[model samples]
Target: MFKAVLSDSNILKTSFDAISSIVDEVQMKADSDGLRLDALDRSHITFVHLEFKSALFDVYQCDEPLKINVDTEELMKVLKRAKSEDIVELTVDEGNFILTFENEARRTFKIRLIDIEYEAPSPPELEYPTEFEIPFSLLKDSIQDISIVSDKIALIVDADKLIASAEGEFGDAKIEYLHGEKITENAKSVFSLEKIKEMLKADKFSETAVLKLGNDMPLNLSLKMVSEEGELTFLLAPRIESEE
Candidate 1:
């Protein structure tokens, strides 16, 4: 048996919302340390890693480790009913995941677990030459602006600045940030604008996001959660242009 309580329900809700867009079902591993999840999208172009440490919860109790397979969309439906200030409690009993919210009134939901056949794959070890930190608001605004003209965006990072640019038949747009920490190496890559937008959904859960990039390689975006207890990370493969 396992039980955990959180004072703010939005933390859990926002997490699910960020992931459910790419994956429908996920396996949540609960242990003494905390809860962890790693899932790849159906196309395998994107991978998501999540962690919520025991200290992040108001109350955490687990005698043994447990892995629960849940449908993210269904879980979001239950979490959607929770008020922002409600205390959220989660428990596992007899193969069922129980969620309870307490505020002025009490609400309870029991969702059945599924037997997941897939196992979490080991993430590839990659080295990014360029790394920088940017506020979520700035990144979100840049993506939105570039997306207006093109379906893909080119990210260029050098010693002094980070740039996002897009061009299409309609027009072209570019946004640059020259305020972040300086980097030694330079890297440039193209990525799907839609995928970046989808991953930005986690911006609501974090203020600042760290980014890593390489030439013609995937983009790694990470958001550290409240109090630095947990993190949500996305690895998006770059969109390669064909030589015709």
Candidate 2:
């Protein structure tokens, strides 16, 4: 038996929104730090790594940091019916799970429990070569522009401009943002459009996005949030090149 109550369900609400689009199933690991999940999308083209502290929830309790695996797609289908301000209650009974959204009215939804086999992916240990601070909102807007053009986007980081471009049947669309002397780079790489779109969904979440680019290697993205409350970081895996 387990019970968790969120002070503002929207935290998990927005979180699941970005994750569900990428991964069908999610393996959530809960411990003293709160609830953490690190899983890649089905195609393995993108990944979502989220960390939610106990303070985010009004009531948080668990036994031995349980690892709960659930079909995120199915759960999201149910959550989509909820309103933003609704208080969400997630509980499990007899190996059966129930989700309740309580606002001025009480709405309880029942979902058929399905068994999911979950495996956690290990993160790399290499020291990131370069790191930069990016405007969160601008980055998201850039993603929208790229998506309208092609399915893939090439990111060229150099001493001059921070570039995001797409080339396809309709020509090419590129956006160059001039930065201050603070940004120092001399390299570039590319990633998929679908991955950028998924990342944009969580754009408004944090103030500045920390981008760590390696030498023609996978890019690491970290979103940092600072409020009067405290600080939080949302880390995401890089999109490595897919072999043909």
Task: Please report the candidate that would top lDDT against the real structure.
Answer: 1
lDDT of 1 by residue, 1-244 (tens): 6999999887787778889888889999899999999999899988999999999999999899989899988898998898898999999888789999998888999988988898865566898888888998999999999988999999999788899998889799999899457688889999998888888877667898889999999999999975998889899999997765
Looking at model 1, the pairs that clash are none
Model 2 misplaced stretches (Cα beyond 4 Å): 168-170, 179-181, 227-244
Model 2 pairs whose backbones collide: none
Candidate 1, 3: how far from true, in Å?
0.4
Clashes of each: 0, 0
Task: Indicate which candidate wins on TM-score.
Answer: 1
| Ten contiguous residues minimizing lDDT sum, candidate 1 | 118-127
After superposing candidate 1 on the true structure, give the runs of residues whose Cα lies further than 4 Å from its correct spot.
none
